[model samples]
Target: MALAGKAAVVIWNDVTPEARSDFLAWHGREHVPERVSIAGFRRGRRGRAVSGGPEFFTLYEVENEAFLGGAYLRRLNDPTPWTRRVMPAFRQASRALCRVEFSLGAGVGGFVATAVLPELADADGAFRSALQRTAEALFAAQSALTGLHLLRCDANASREKTAEHGLRRETPELPAGVLLAEAGDAAPLADVVAGFSEKMASETGRRFEAGRIAIYRLELCLAAGEVLPPWDGSPTFAGEGD
Candidate 1:
C-alpha cells in the first residue's frame, strides 16, 4: 500500500534508558491509539532502531496536511496524564508534518530504512519531480521492499507550539525532506538503501548521503479501526506541567 492519504506526521526521538519501560507502556497503550482515533488520522506505527539514528521512530498517516493543525493540534495541546509523564523521556525529538510526495508498495513491512534528505530546492518543481521519478524507478526494481515513500515537511504545522512541547526537555526539531523504505526483514535493506542513495545522487546531481540511512524494526502498530477508548482510571495522573 502507498500511504493512507496525502500527508503524514513523521517523528524521530530517543527515550532515555531510565524511562524506557514507562515510555513503551505509555506509547503502545495510550498514545498512538488515541491519536489514530482522532478524525483524520488513519494509522500509527512505532519502530525501534535495529541499526542507526534515533532509538524510536513514529509515523502517523493523515488525510491531508490540514488535519495537522486541526484536531491533532488540539490533542497535542491537551496532553493526557500518561503523555505528560512520557514527554520528559524524549530526547533529540524531531517531528515533521509532511506532504507525501511519492509512495509505492505492497503494504508496510516489519523492517524499514529512512534517510533524512536535505531540504529540496522548492523553486524547481521539475527538479523535485525528476527525483520522484527516479525514486519510482528504484522502487520498481527492488524485490525485498514492501514500501517506499518520499515526504516533504510542512514547516508551519510542525513548529506550532503546544502544551506538550513545554513538557519536553528540549524543543522538537522540524522534519526535513525524508525518504523511507520498508521491507519485510532486515537482511536485504543495507544493499538496497545504499543503491537508493547512489542512484538518487546520480539522478539529482548532488551527493545523497547513504551513511545517513537508519534501520528500524516495527515495534507496534495501530489503526483507527483498532482504537480503544481512552482510560480514566489513574487517580494520580498528572497532567502536563505537573
Candidate 2:
C-alpha cells in the first residue's frame, strides 16, 4: 500500500529497563488502541533500537495535517490515568508531526533506519525533486531495503509540547525532514543507508547533520481490533478517583 495517509506522527524515546514491562503493557494494551480509535488516526507501529541507545520509536499514521493540531492535540492534553502513570517514566522523548511526502514499499520489515535531515532555507522545490530522484534510484536497485519514505515536519506541531505533562527532558528542536529506510537485516541496511545519505548530500548539496540517524529493530506491533493478552490486574483509568 502506498503510504496510507497524508500525515504521520513520529515519536522516539526510551524508558528504564525496570519499567520496560509496564511501559510495553501500557503502550501495547492501552495507548496504541486509544490513539488508533481517535477520529483521524489510521494505524500505529512501534520499534526498538537494535544498536542505538534510548531504544524505542513509534509511528502513528494520520489522515491529514489538521489531525495533529486538532484531535491528536486534544488526546495528548487529556491523558488517561494509565497514560499519566506510564508517560512520566519516558525519558529522552522526541516527537514530530510530519507531512508524508513519499512512500515506496510493499511490506513491513525486521529493521528500519531513519535519516533526519534539516530543512533547507529557501530551496524546497530543489530539495524535493532531488529526494524524489534518489528515491527512484533506490527503488530501482531492488536491494535489501524493503521500504523507503519521506516526511516533512509541520513546524507548529513539531514543538516539544510534552513539557507541560511533566516529563522533564528538554524537547529536541525538530528536524526539517525525515528519511526512512527499512530492511530485514540491520547491519547491511545501515551500510546502505550511510551510502545513500552520502549520495543524497552530494546530489542535493545538503547535509543531514542536525539530527541523529539510527536503526531500530521491530519489537512488538499492534493494530486496531487485535486482541491483546488478557490483563487480569487491577483496573486503571485516568479520571478514576483513587
Candidate 3:
C-alpha cells in the first residue's frame, strides 16, 4: 500500500423495494466502473447503508492534490458519456471528505456512522442487539464482507472540531461507530452495496429510516512518523491519536 489522497462521496437517495436488487447490481457492475475510469482515479468502491435508508458511500483514490484540483473537477462534473448514462440510477446528495493522505496499511478501511446512537440511546441492550443484527444482515447479504467492529467511546477519547463542511469530533459520550470491509479495489464494491440492501430489508422488517442512518468513507491517515504494521493476521486497534 502507499500514501494516496482519498476522496469519498456520500449520497442519500430514494430507492424502491422493487428496484433495490437492480440498483445494487447496477452500481457494482456499471456505475462504479465508470467513475473509477476517470483520470486521477486509482481505486473506487461503493457501499450501502444497511438500515433501509437512502444513504450510500463511494470512495475514490487519487494520485495527489493536483489530480483532485481544477482538471479533476472539470472531468467529474463533466463526466464522460458513460457516466452520463449511469447517473440516473442514483439520487445523490454529495459531501466531500476533506483531503487526507493515508499510509498503505493492513486494516480493511475505517468508517464513522453518526446520527444513529441518538435513535438507539434510549433503548440500551435492545439497541445494541438491533445494531449488531443490522450489521450482520449487511455482511450476510454481501458475502465479500470480512469484519465489522463496534467501538464504544471512552471518556478520555472525546474531542470535537467544527468547520464549514460539518462538525467532526470523537467523544465517548457521543457513541461512535466504525466498520471494516475487505476490499482490494473498486471493482468488487458493488456486490457489497447490493448485498447491504437485502440484508437491511431482512433485518429491519422492510422499513427503512432515512434520517437515522449516516455512512462515512474513511482514508486511514497515520500520524506523523507512524509506520504501517506488518500484516500478521492479528487483531489490532489504534488508540486515540495514534
* Best candidate according to lDDT: 1
Predicted candidate 1 versus true structure: per-residue lDDT over 1-242, tens digit per residue: 88888999888889899999889878887989888988889999999999987888999999887788878888888999889988988998877789988788899899988778765445267667776777777778887889888788877867777998787754444546878889998887877767777776777786665335688999898988896645454434458456
lDDT of 2: 0.74
Give the per-residue lDDT digits (tens) of candidate 3, residues 1-242: 33234433223354445656665555554545555555565666455554334456554555544554454455545554444443444443333322331122333544433232222122246554665676666655644444333223222212222221121111123322222244344334444443433454455554322224444444322222233433333456779557
Error of 3 at 184 (Å): 14
Q: Could you tell me the TM-score of candidate 2? A: 0.85
Listed in order, each prediction's TM-score against the native is 0.87, 0.85, 0.39
Q: lDDT of all the models against the reference?
A: 0.81, 0.74, 0.41
Q: Candidate 3: deviation at residue 221, Å?
A: 19
Candidate 1 wrongly placed segments (more than 4 Å): 123-125, 170-173, 206-211, 228-242
Write down the RMSD of all candidates, one decimal each.
6.0, 5.5, 16.6
Query: Candidate order by lDDT, highest to lowest?
Result: 1, 2, 3
lDDT accuracy of residue 63 in candidate 1:
88
Give the Å error, residue 31, model 2. 0.4
TM-score: which is higher, 2 or 3? 2
Give the deviation of candidate 3 from the true structure as CA RMSD.
Answer: 16.6
User: How well does candidate 3 match the true structure in TM-score terms?
Assistant: 0.39
Model 1 TM-score, all chains together: 0.87
